[model samples]
Target: MTQEEEKKKQRTRNLVVGGILFALVILFYLITVVKMTGTGA
Candidate 1:
């Protein structure tokens, strides 16, 4: 409930969200590559 604790919590949340977004981007990139190569069929 302290200011420092709040900042730490916010930073952790931001990192987790950023990581999820990054993983989704990589997943989409891989899917696109597979589809373009006609290997997904």
Candidate 2:
């Protein structure tokens, strides 16, 4: 593949992985916050 094609593929993969990681990080933060608060939310 050409450089452009390779870059496009890498960009797509980065977006997908980044989205998953963002979601997991949000979930982790929320869980920790709830645990610390003991709000049982």
Score residue 17 of candidate 2 by CA lDDT. Answer: 100
**Poorest lDDT segment (10 consecutive residues) of candidate 1:** 32-41
**Candidate 2 residue spans exceeding 4 A from truth:** none
lDDT per residue for candidate 1 within 1-41, as digits (tens), equals 99999999999999999999999999999999999999998
Once model 1 is optimally superposed onto the true structure by TM-score, how far is the C-alpha of residue 20 displaced, in angstroms?
0.4
Candidate 2, overall lDDT? 0.97
- RMSD of candidate 1 to the truth, in angstroms, is 0.5
C-alpha lDDT (0 to 100) for residue 34 of candidate 2 = 94
Query: Under the 3 Å rule for N, CA and C atoms, how many clashes does model 2 have?
Result: 0
